[model samples]
Target: MSRLYSDIFTNRASTGQASADLSEAHPKFAVNKVDFWYPGKQALYNISLTIPERSVVAFIGPSGCGKSTLLRVLNRMNDLIDGTRHTGDVNLDGKNIFAPEVNLVDLRRRVGMVFQKSNPFPKSIYENVVFGPRVAGQRDRARLDYLVERCLKQSALWNEVKDRLHTSALALSGGQQQRLCIARALATDPEVLLMDEPASALDPKSTNAIEDLIFELKKDYTIVIVTHNMQQAARVSDVTAFFFEGKLVESGLTEKIFTRPTQRQTEDYITGRFG
Candidate 1:
């Protein structure tokens, strides 16, 4: 049954202007008829969506609804898991990201990801932010230092951590650690940032901090976030996509999805009627 629906969605995604216009508008990241499987169980249906450039698009859905799966597919993070299979096209700025000729290292550099849990390196706050640029062959101290400050400020952590840049990232609170992780992701100067429930574990205050950072960062980088919090989605995203049972139930402007959803399932889920 899942496969049948996947095929139908894939067909519709491929034979229409949805994919084309998505690329036209964003030209940063485009997923067309995307499908994924883990050892024979389909995890994502033909999920097609366009992420507008320098904008935040939030994915909201119940547990096991494939929100995280879809976010990982955008940056090919699923490839890290064993026995994972994927089909269809994901383009970054009009280039096929899944192409054999594409360099995984470079692709990851362009498309950075922040996981649900904050996993900062054991190194100091300064080291975590400069790690990516160093690995990318940036050897100049001046350039690395400049990037470190820029990224930390961009992630809204510079003012808090600047005085102790040499302090270990692990020494910070959970929220600070997450922001450090975000700074690390930004250090690479990625064109697209994929976040999976980035603030799910933080306190309300910390969550607000992250939310504000997302709102501000969208001015420079395109962001795709998977979040279970409906209000957070409404607050941070310009577009909202509702997923259920591995399918894209509906998507549109955030206001529309929250206040006037077109699908009954979407309305129900948004209004606390059902999962």
Candidate 2:
């Protein structure tokens, strides 16, 4: 009874197409008329969206507007909640991830995630970075060493922590720990990275580092982030999706979404009239 994501696809049966940015290039992930319910309350309603490959997309809205809920849906994290029910399709590379045949472990490995606060394992820094590969049966120490270095470098944390690889991960600052988490996610060579407020708990300097890392990571991994910082979304994401009351009010290029949203609801929220 593993969890599932978008695993089925059908145009007529689909109910959550929010906007028309579906170009010829198949989206890395597609949310088609997705509706979610938790017990008696509906957290999301008819939400349709698409994520392209090798790009950074941001989900922004007031708290409880389903920004993070939808983010969780990407990796099937929501499935862990009791009495939660979902409909519609969430397609990754045109395959509905919810299909029974889909391997949740493999899906999680390919679609890695970072959370709002750093949650490094209580282990050595080197161990933290190599844990994923090591668990999958990687025992060659030289190969493990190379993987750790490469992943940490990709996450921009190799330089600062190289001298302390054997130190407890909990000893690092909040930013370094978060980057270590990112490095750990990268160790598996995931094609997509999901970040749920990856910088909200850090200082300004740490936030900037995470933002910079996002910029660099976009070249190799398709990224989606849920953020409360509008400015941070603008700075780090190429596309933005604005959610209101669990519905996708508007989505488009970051510039257009910020500067010229066609929907009045989007304008009101973005302009500070209301959230």
Candidate 3:
């Protein structure tokens, strides 16, 4: 049976245990001893990592190394896949996300995501930015108008498209559309953003724009990005995690991971000796 999104629109307070757990102090996200499977195959094996709040963490590895899979695990996006399962805990702000009480809708609202390809809704730019807030029952026209401008400015696309807010989002260039998507994610006021190779499909200039946005967004939102681009990872991430064959080979400061990785596999992958 599928798991139902708990509590719908109800705003349940954090449990006493959840409140007390906060006293112990932990990172924004704590994935401990996690093992994940997709039907017949295992995708991740006993992975553990901590992501500090208001920082960018990059997962870099060859394709199929489980970087994207782990990215989806953050907000339980994998739950949409049939027969997928995982063991262990993924905690956000000291609360286990897999706990029965976690409201899926709220969890997703708090942890917004962007994909490798820019996927703007076929609607107007204004509509795209206000989508999330509207779905959550926000009806104040003034507030929504404010969100559109604020989020677009935060995404660095306000000046470029401010005059065309009513234009279809698809009318924008690739980079602009991507920024619009970023603005949409920000509209929900998410605390965390999960980006799966967010710029891999864009041109160099567009890629740079996305990278700059990531740098700016990290000041307010914790970000986890999966990228095959080693240079991009090195440039944008505060911390880097290297994975190989579903196992976390090494993870640490980006400088250390790139210049002084302890694991031979990590060194080999980063040095272009092997993927």
The prediction achieving the highest lDDT against the true structure is 3
Q: What are the Cα lDDT values of the candidates? A: 0.84, 0.86, 0.87
lDDT of 2 by residue, 136-158 (tens): 89999999999999999999999
Worst 10 residues of 1 by lDDT: 15-24
Report residue 58 deviation for candidate 2 (angstroms): 0.4
| lDDT (10s digit) by residue, model 1, range 59-105 | 99999999998888877888999999988898888888889899988
Query: So what's the TM-score on candidate 1?
Result: 0.89
Candidates in order, TM-scores: namely 0.89, 0.90, 0.90
Which tens-of-lDDT digit does each residue in 4-53 have in candidate 3?
Answer: 11221011122211101122334999999999999999999999999888
Q: TM-score-based ranking, best first?
A: 3, 2, 1
Model 3: which residue pairs collide? none
Which parts of model 2 are misplaced by more than 4 Å?
A: 1-26
- Model 1, runs deviating above 4 Å: 1-24
Error of 3 at 72 (Å): 0.3
Candidate 2 Cα deviation (angstroms), residue 232: 0.5
Of models 1 and 2, which has the larger TM-score? Answer: 2
Candidate 1 clashes between residue pairs 3 or more apart in a chain or in different chains = none
